[model samples]
Target: MQKKSALGIMVLAILFVSVNLRPAISSIGPLLDTIRADLSLSSSEVSLLTSVPVFCMGLFAPLAVVFNKKLGLKNSIAILVAAIGLFTLLRGILPTYPVLLISAFFIGLSIAIISPLLSAMIKRNFPTRTASLIGVYSFGMGLGATLAAGLTGVFYSVAGWPIALASWGLLAIAAILLWLRVKEPVAEVSELPLEGAASVSPWKNRRAWYMLLFFGFQSALFFSVITWLAPIAIEKGMSILVAGAVLTVMSTVQIACNLSIPLLLERWPSRHLWIMVSLGFGAAGVLLLMFADMIFIWPAAICIGITLGGLFPLALLMPLDENKTADDVNSWSSMIQSGGYIISALTPFTIGLFYDRFQNHMISLSLFLGFIAILTVFAFLLNKKPESAGE
Candidate 1:
């Protein structure tokens, strides 16, 4: 009974942390206009503020593994979650644009630490159910993104942007408290080598590099849309409510697809095919938003969201599938996430810069989506290669 209770607490803690991770990033889109207007931010500035935390996601992700080794997963997650709570809360009260921007960097860094640790924790705690647990983690992430898109917009309309921003920090607090309830199982500690735990280096593996590129590019694609999709809808003559609804629909579809894909992956020998299929769907989504009339927007939104749901988790799962030991998984997780998030951090700003230069959304959207499509194809080939599989 005690074990079951502890297990339940850990699960809830994981879910709560997962749910808060993306809202810090996702909430920016709906509130972008207000934040920009109030702060007199330029287009580039808006993009930068939004993208900075994401960049920190890459910059700080590698540090988590180091901390994990020293603190163990239990203590590391608690400290990181507290940091996330602190920074997220600070983001709400910051007095200037620079302060907010700096806050984003710290917020991003905090979440980055939490991200890889969760995956490593699951591998340590639930070895037999890694895939399914990861699926649940993915679903929680999507749900956070969905809530940011849907609820933040509503909150922004009702109470304004600061309130919307401040409200999300509460999730961090909730996660911190929940994390406090977890006690690390002895089996989890047994998995780590006590002697010279720091000797294992995941950077030596070529597969880690591949996973890094795959995860980063896929992340770039996910954030590009999350940051801009609603604005795109509004640009295409849809009302704000409609645009927000479209994003909501997309999030809902993503949640459904994320939950379903792991089961399918279990049946298939290679998930590489599904990765390409997701990119194809994402390409179609961006294209539809770029060129098609309003009638096609919902379907396109759904495609993008659902496709991301599968692709994002698939990226996280790659290192897990490939690594036999938790340390290897941690190293691969840090490398891939650090690389992936660095790429992701630049995407929105890059897209925003192009839009500022040309005042053309289609060209920017097309090129971004097209680039992701090509990368996805490359990743598919690479992931499908016999070498992509673990020993």
Candidate 2:
């Protein structure tokens, strides 16, 4: 009975923290134009709103190990969540470009570190249930993005961009509260290594590089769609509200798949096959967006949603699948995410730059096709050269 109660709380605590991770980035999409026009920023410059955080998420991911060794998983997450909340709140309170940029960096860093810590947390607590818990974690993030994408427009209409942007921080407060309820097992805490816990960097392995590239391209596709999908909808003669609704559809569809794909993977566990399926959906999504526009907006969103839903959990599983020990999962995941995020971080800003240069959403959308193709190649490569056990 005690065990059941604690597990329930742990699940809720995971949901809360996972939910807070993406809003700082996703919320900006619905309000991008308003922000750009109000602040006199260019498309590329505004793209930094998403890019900077992603950049930090990649560059600072190794800090996860450093944080775990010093503060312990429990305290590290608490501090990071608090920082996420504080920075998110500051965005609304300060409401300046410089402040927004600065706040974005810290928010991204905090999120970056929390990721591996949470993975470590899940590994320690639910060794046998990692896949299901990862689904929960992914679903929570999808839920956060869906809410932000769907409702930030409403929030902006009601209280303006400052409040809409800043209000997301409140999620952190709730996360912190529930997170307190999740007590780490004493044994797990006592076994935590302090000095020289790091393993050979994932960078040293070739298959690890393949995993990084695969993660990077898939993530690039995901973040690009998140940042630009709504604006492209609006460009096709939809209202901001309708555009927001379109993004809502994309994210909502992703949530359903985020939950379902793991179940599907249970039956068919081929990473290459699943990823190829996802990239096919992504290609169709981009083509539809470019050629069909709002006429097939729902279809495009759904296709992209399928692609995102399938790819993320698969990416999360890669290191976990390759590694046996929790430490290996932690080390490989940090390297994969660190390099993957850095590479993926460039897509949004690059798309924005292309839009500015070509003044055409077609060109920006074409880039998606390019990313999908590149991703498909790496997907094939990763499968062709499977990482050896304990590699």
Candidate 3:
């Protein structure tokens, strides 16, 4: 009973930390115009508020393993979470472009370092329940994005942009307090091979490379839709209000899927089937958006949202499922994420290039379809053998 209670507390703490991951970045979107007007910033300059952090997520993800090796799991998480909270609070307190830029870098650094380590922590503590716990983790992140995007504008009306951005820090403070109540994870040495898991380099692992490529394309698909779905709707002749509704549908379904997919994996555990289904939804949605009339928009949104929600928790589960020890999961996840996010961050820019040359939303959507097809091939290769499949 005591163990159960401790697990409950730990899960809540994980949820809190998962939520803090996004508000420092997502909050900027809702108030972008207001922020730009106040600061008199150009579009390219203002765009860095988001892109800089994404680049940092890719560039700094490997630091997660470094922190784990040097500071140990609990210390690393605590320090990183503190960095997230402190930099976020500084954004509100300082409230200038240069300070905001500086704060964004630190906030991004904190998130990058903590993400993979947290995955290993979940695997270590809830070895049996890793799937459901991951569901909770991704659910918390999706909830964070929703809350930040939905409420930040309202908060700005009540306070100024500074206070609005800073209000998110209160959530971080609550996260820190709750996180203190949970105990750190212990390494499971007996389960690992004779060779220490820590010494294994993911750079040489073919499976880890597969995981990296899979993660990159899936993230690219999700972010491309997030960045382009509404614009696509508008380009296809929907009014601005109607276009926003399509994006809302996608987001709503995504959050629901993020909460549910890992739980489904807990019961079904057929990774290949879920992976194919999720990718199929993504491909179908893109096709519908590209070729079908606006009447098909609702179905496309629902399908894409389902794909967004399902793929992430599954991608997260892959490393945990493959590795025996927390250290191995950390190495594998960090390696996967490090290269994965760089692939993801470049996607929007590449798509913009396609748009520049072709000048049609259809051209971009067609490119999305081609990527999805390639992703499907990788999916089959990754899960073709029964051994590789999380059966």
Off by over 4 Å in 2: 186-201, 323-325, 385-391
Q: What Cα-based lDDT does every candidate model obtain?
A: 0.76, 0.85, 0.76
Best candidate, lDDT-wise? 2
- State the lDDT of candidate 2 residue by residue for 236-268, as single tens digits: 888788889999999998888778877888899
Residue-by-residue lDDT tens digits, candidate 1, 69-181: 68877787778777766666676687467777877887788787777678667867887987677767877888888988888878777777787776887887788788888
Clashes of 1: 1
Return the TM-score for each candidate structure.
0.88, 0.92, 0.77
- Predicted candidate 3 versus true structure: per-residue lDDT over 62-112, tens digit per residue: 676567768877777888888888887887889999988888788888888
Show model 1 residue runs off by greater than 4 Å: 65-75, 184-208, 320-329, 383-391
lDDT pick, better of 1 and 2 = 2
| The candidate that achieves the highest TM-score relative to the unseen native structure | 2
lDDT measured at residue 45 in model 3 versus the true structure, 0 to 100: 54
The stretch of ten residues in a row with the least summed lDDT in candidate 2 is 187-196
Candidate no. 1 TM-score:
0.88
Arrange candidates by TM-score, highest first: which order? 2, 1, 3
Report lDDT (Cα) of residue 304, candidate 2.
Answer: 93
Predicted structure 2: clash tally: 0
